[model samples]
Target: MGLLDELESEAQRRKSNDEDASVLKAARETAYRTVLEPAMADLLAYLKELAAKLTELQPKIAIRHSLAGYGDVVAYVEHEFDVREVRQPSSKEITVAFHAAVSSSECPSVQIEGGARVRAVSASFQRHRLGAPLAASKDASGEVVAATFKAKGRIPLTAVFSADAASGQLRLSFSNFDDFATAVKTVAPDQVNEELYDKIGRYLMREPTDLMREVLPENYRSQLRARVHHEEVKRRWESQIVSRQQEDIALLKREYGIGARFNRIGDAMGKLRGLVSRK
Candidate 1:
């Protein structure tokens, strides 16, 4: 047979075992494309984005923190309140802690001990507040210059596929309780069929993913631009003040040098004039 005829015969041979062949291909394809590389890309993007966002953010922020309403949004670090008793150090000096419960209803704040490690959330967004628009926070000393108001934002999306075509029935066809528990934890587990994967993908994509995004504020662009402009202006002003101070110092040095040489030059010119007159 010719090369094309041999290839046709091979294709026919594969078609006879199509069911098993398809399962093997699907496993390999999902492993290579959907799980490994895609997962890596997603994780890298998340890490990089978080790193950039938290670079300028503070670890512990003073905010009027509440989960009810959004305030001026910015980087925030949450703190875990723990009750622990102070204990004497051992030879290894490992600090040990046990659950310290109290009869009081309120969770009392404990004074932090020096050199003792406490539970804390670091390098996370607390909330962004405006210098002008936000309310000023103050203390016994004086007025505090910190961002007060905080708000949050969400990403928007649009559906690319039609509703009728995308709609599907997700029913519990299997009777395995262990499989159901695993599915609840990770959406899938070993011995689970491929249709479950497809159903999860479709559900996630359409419900919370890009297919159905969020609604943003109308003046979001203006607000973002204004915030950036304020930051740039503050930076520029400080830079100009530093540069202007340096320039003034240099100008003073130049003027003082000229003043120091003026009298000596004048005296030399007088002596030279006197010598010329005598000649």
Candidate 2:
């Protein structure tokens, strides 16, 4: 067939495949929104509330990111708490500790241990308060400083949140534990941002394979197939060089006065020279 005819046939084949591919993509996205996304959003919202409550006790919390069977990112928080020290005149010193907690489960119930001295104190109480927003400030490194708090023991919390459509999956890596705790406490149960929830939900429900097929157009796929064919043709052409060299040697011996063996060598050298010059 002529080059034009061959190209027309290829185009026709791609057009047929393109229609089916578009239909399949549309169906998949519909199914994702109607079924998969709602389920994922419910699970994510529950996890967010649970993690927020748990982390509210201290200023810091750790959240590990996971999707389908893959682990993506790890986040940590550093918390800071106000410490009050009471020193009595009778050589007795008393230290009182307080931190915020969301619920009874989140209350810091352990006693302060270690070499930290505490003398005869009349009374001590642990008061849990609600976390509030911190004024904007810059850290020593010139980065925007977020709220943080100090507390005993290492507590890990897990939460799932997503990003915008263009940004993709957003795994929040909270370095300021205190800020996370404050966010949990300050964010009212009924006041959660619906837009944020939807964005995060969409991200969590996203499937990589589906996303790949969605982003790649039918024309791009056709181009990729053509490129693959071209590469295979190039490889096969290289494999036939040795036989072509032999054929050249026979022709040289029969037609010209050159030796058959020298013809093969000369043809091989010429091919190498062409390759080097092209590079």
Candidate 3:
């Protein structure tokens, strides 16, 4: 009935739900260790080897690129490799994917075309009686940038490697051509830090939801953080409510010589009221 009682009830409800959440969390952690972790390790190892091979082939990168403009325009783009896991609703199959598919953001802008469409008319009289020149222009050049340039070669540059948990199967899928495998070649050892993999592993093992949150867009992540903060604050407030109510009951008992027989605040208050009337 009182604020303290309401808060205590809510806390009890949360405590019950937290038991269910804990079970689910434990199962997810088990799944991560038994299934996802091995796949992730395998994938990371494969990528490391692939990256080393690409680096060894770095010298061949120049052969794939064409020179343009007055000076050599060397463009270096970083390949962003994203990792994510998907769970199929139908079968509840978990699949982890290492995404290296080329995006426009990973491509360099090389402007190779420079020109304009123009129209002009000129007339001159035989005796130089009259001479006139007229000029007009029309736009024709499409805004072609280096990003549009498709990478040539049979090499699988933009590829996705997905591992299925249930079947323990690994699949490879490819998208976008490689104009230059330079990006893959340039991946520094430090850039692919082991710490990142460790963090991912830890998330998958202990907090899978946190891993999902990590990949969320900035705005969405902010919203998630705010919601989580709200829940934490509410939990702390409820705890404080319980503590404050318990302290009040203890103080009342001390002041009124009330026995430990009473439990509820309402009962304590009623007893206090009766004592005051008698006094």
Q: What TM-score would candidate 2 get against the native?
A: 0.25
Candidate 1 lDDT over residue span 1-279, tens digit each = 999999999998888789787776566545434343333333234434433443445234322222222212222222222112222221001111111111112222222221211111111113211112134444467634332322332211111110010111111211111111112222111212444334433432222322112345769978988999999999999999999999999999999999879988999999999999999
Each candidate's number of clashing pairs is 17, 12, 3
lDDT against true structure, model 2: 0.39
Ranking by TM-score: 2, 3, 1
Listed in order, each prediction's TM-score against the native is 0.22, 0.25, 0.24
Q: Stretches of candidate 1 above 4 Å error?
A: 1-114, 118-216, 263-279
Query: By TM-score, how accurate is candidate 1?
Result: 0.22
| Root-mean-square deviation (CA) per prediction | 23.0, 23.9, 29.3
Ranking by lDDT: 3, 2, 1
lDDT of 3 by residue, 1-279 (tens): 999999999999999999998886676555545655565565566555544554455322211222222122222323333444443431122223222222323334332332311111111111111122122222456432221222211222344444433333333332322222221111212223455445434432223323222244799989989999999999999999999999999999796664544446778899999999999
Better of 1 and 3 by lDDT: 3
Q: Which portions of model 3 miss their true places by more than 4 Å?
A: 1-11, 59-74, 77-279
